[model samples]
Target: MERLYQGIVRFRESDYQSHKDLFKELGQSQSPHTLFIGCSDSRVVPNLITQTLPGELFVIRNVANIVPPYRDTNDYVATLSAIEYAVKALNVENIVVCGHSNCGGCNALFAPEETLNAVPHVKKWLEISHGVKEKILREYPDADAQKREWMTEQMNVVQQMKNLLSYPYIKERYQEGKLSILGWYYIIETGEVFSYNKESMEFELVTDTFTP
Candidate 1:
């Protein structure tokens, strides 16, 4: 806790001071251009990875970076509510679904039911992406653990991108070319990011000169 407080002090003295005007302007209103949906992993820092400053990206993070298919319900839906506000209210032009290598949520999908039972809520939340494991098994029943892990991470990103389209506003904007949806797979240790290509159905390396 002290470490976090010290970090805040450092930010207030250094990074915050340097960006004082930007912060001041952001205090009144924010018009972020993208909605970045990423995992709740400590290592997956969306702003740091994207090199985006304040008021540029609205982020929503959760276990596995899951995006449940659009639904009408009276229940409390935190992730869905955030998506709605970012799109309908904030009018973000882009939405990114980022998944990373060696994701614990991905690993959790393959865990035995007995193991998952211990974390009931997490188990229920991950059910949204359970089809990812089924698809991998159906295609490569003999795939080893390493192969399965990477595949799960990448496939989960694409699955969430599809799930995002299930939202009526997002789908309309997407078809009208008013909105862009991207699926990214990040390799933590190597600091590499791969963006999915809808045309080729592959994840290609994102380089300095890369054009999406």
Candidate 2:
């Protein structure tokens, strides 16, 4: 808590002062360009990785970076509401679903009943990506633990990207070429990012000349 307090003090004195004008302008309203859906992992810093500043990316972080398929229901949906607001109200042009290597949430999907029983809500939320687990198992039946981890993480990103388009607004905008969806796989320890190429059906390493 003390460390966080000191960091806040530094932010107010230094970072905030440096960006005072931008902050003041953003205080009035935010028009972010992208909606970044990513994991709640401490290591995956979306702004830091993307080199984006405040108000540039509207972010949604949750376990496994899941996006539930579009459904008309009376239930309260936090992530779904946020996505709607970003696309319809903020008019974000792009939506990026990022999944990272060695994701605990991805692993949790394969955990035993006792393991997941400890976090019932998380287990329930992860059901959104249950198809990811099934696909991985069906497609890579011979894969070992390490192979399964990366495959699950990468495939989960693709699954969420598909789920995003289930939203009517997103699908319409996408078909009209007014919007873009990107799936990314980030390697935490090595700091290498890979972008999914839908046509190639592969996760290509993001390099100097790479374009999303």
Candidate 3:
């Protein structure tokens, strides 16, 4: 808590002061260009990673960067409401679902039921990625541990992109070419990022010549 307070003090005295005019303008209204859906992992800071300024990216972080499929029921209302507002009200042009290499949520998916019994809610929440696990097993049944985990993390991002499409308004905008959905994989150890290519159905390094 002391560290957080010191960081706040630094922000108020230095970071905020340096960007006073930007902050002041943002106070009036914000028009972010992208909706960044990323993991709740402490290592993955959306603003820091993307080098985006305040009011640049409207972000929603959750376990494994999961975006539940659009449903009429209010099971995951918080996440769903944020998505609705970002798309319908804010009209963000891009939605990026980012997943990291060593995601605890992805690992928990393969843990024994007894191990996850204590965190029932977390266990339930991770069910969103069950399909990813199934797909991996069906396709890469002989893959080793490292390969499976990496694949799961990447596939989870793709799955969430599909889930975002389940929203009618999002789908409409996407079809009209007003909005784009992107899947990104961040490698924690190497500090490298890869963007999913729908055409090739593979994740290519962001620095590569491949266009999305």
Candidate 4:
């Protein structure tokens, strides 16, 4: 907390000072061009990874970066609200859902055969990984540990991307060509980011997408 406080002080004194006009303008309103949905894991930071400045990316972080499938029930209201506000209200053109390598949340999907001693909320939250696990079991029934981990991490991105589209507002905007959704895998150790192409359904090196 102390470190965070010092960082805040520095931001207010120097970082904010350097961008005084931009901060002042953003103080009144924010019109971010992208809605970055990512895991709450400390390692994955959309702005830092992309070198985006403040007021540029509207961020939503959650355990495992799970966007639950759209539901008519009360459960999806919060996630739906953000999507609606980003697409309908804020009019953000891009929506990026980022996953990462060595995700603890994704690992726990097949781990801990028993949950009696685990945190209840965390267990519930990680339930989203069941789909990924099932896919692994069915597709690679005899896969070894490394294969399972890699596939789960990969498939989890696709499942979550599909879940993002389940919202009516998101679907409508996508159909009208008002929005675009991107799935990404940020490899921490390599310091490389790979983007999953929807049409190709493959994670291609981001080098092809951006030069700088």
Candidate 5:
């Protein structure tokens, strides 16, 4: 806690002061170009990874970067509300769902519920990706444990992209070419990022191709 306070002081004295004008402009209003949805992993810092400053990307981080299908009920209201506001109000041109390597939420998908006994709410939240687990088991029955985990992480990103489409406003904007939904896989060990190609149905390195 003291460390955080010290960091705040340093920011006020340095980074914030250096970017005062930009922050001042942002104080009035923000017009971010992208809505970045990423995992809650401490290792995955969206702004740091993307090298984006404040007001550039509106970010939402959650366990495994999961996005539940649009529902009429109030469940998952925080995430749902952010998605709606980003699309309908902010009119963000791009929505990126980024999943990272070795995600605990993705690993939890294969673990027995009892393994998550201490985090019951987390267990419940992970159920949103149950279909991803089922699809992997059905299609890649012979895959090894490491392979399964990697596949689950990548597939979850694609699944969330589909979930984003369930929102009417997002769908309308997407169909009109006003919005683009992207899936990204980030490898933490190597600092490499892969973007999903809808045409090839494969995740290619961002350095190799520019789909978004």
Candidate 6:
């Protein structure tokens, strides 16, 4: 806690001070161009990775970076509300879903329910795993594998992209060509990002020239 406090103090004295005018302008209001959704893992800092300053990226992060299928469920309503606000109100031009390697949530997906519910909510949250789990079981039932989990992580990004499309406002923007939805995989160890190409149904290396 003390370290966090000191970091804030440093921000106020240094980074904030240096960007004081930009901060002052942002204080009036914000119209960020992107909505970046990623996991709440400490290792995944959206702003740091993107090098976007305050008021530049509106972000929503949750366990496993999961975006549940759109429905009338009481759960995930808050997250959906944020997405509505970002796409409809803020009119952000981009929505990026980023997943990272070595994610605990991804790893834990392979474990049994009894061992998982030390935090019941985590178990429930990752229940987004249902379809993916069935796929793995049906495809590779005999294997114990991290590769299977990795495949799920990749698919999960695509699935969340589908979930994002479930919101009508996003769909409208997409149809009009005002917005782009991106699914990204960030390799933690290598500092490389792979982008999902809808046309190819594959993830391709994001070249160095690419901003994302």
Q: Candidate 3's residue-wise lDDT over 1-212, tens digit each?
A: 99999999999999999999999999989999999999999999999889999999999999999998888984648899999999999999999999999999998889999988999989999998899989999999999999999999999999999999899999999999999999999998899999999988999998757567
List model 2 lDDT by residue over 83-180, tens digit each. 99999999999999999988999999999999999999999999988999999999999999999999999989999999998999999999999999
Error in Å for residue 97 of model 6: 0.5
User: Which candidate has the top score in TM-score?
Assistant: 1
Q: What is the C-alpha lDDT of each candidate?
A: 0.96, 0.95, 0.93, 0.83, 0.93, 0.86
Residue 49's lDDT within candidate 4 is: 94
Evaluate residue 79 in candidate 1 and report its C-alpha lDDT on the 0 to 100 scale: 100
**Candidate 1: Cα lDDT at 168:** 98
Query: What lDDT, from 0 to 1, does candidate 4 have?
Result: 0.83
Candidate 1: which pairs clash?
none
> How do these models rank on TM-score, best leading?
1, 2, 3, 5, 6, 4
Candidate 1, residue 107: the lDDT equals 94
Task: Supply candidate 1's per-residue lDDT for 61.
Answer: 96
Model 2: lDDT of residue 25: 96
Best by lDDT: 1
The positional error of residue 194 in candidate 5, measured at the CA in angstroms, is: 0.1
**Cα distance off (Å), candidate 1, residue 44:** 0.1
What lDDT does model 5 reach?
A: 0.93
Model 1 spans > 4 angstroms off: none
lDDT by residue for model 4 (25-97), tens = 9989999999998988999888899999899998988877888777776554566678678778898999888
Provide backbone clash counts, one per model.
0, 0, 0, 0, 0, 0
Candidate 5 residue 4 Cα shift, in angstroms, is: 1.2
User: If both were scored by lDDT, which would come out higher, candidate 1 or candidate 2?
Assistant: 1
The sequence of per-residue lDDT tens digits that candidate 6 reaches over residues 156-188 is 788889888887778888999999999999888
Itemize residue pairs with steric clashes in candidate 3.
none
> Pairing residues by index, what is the TM-score of model 3?
0.96
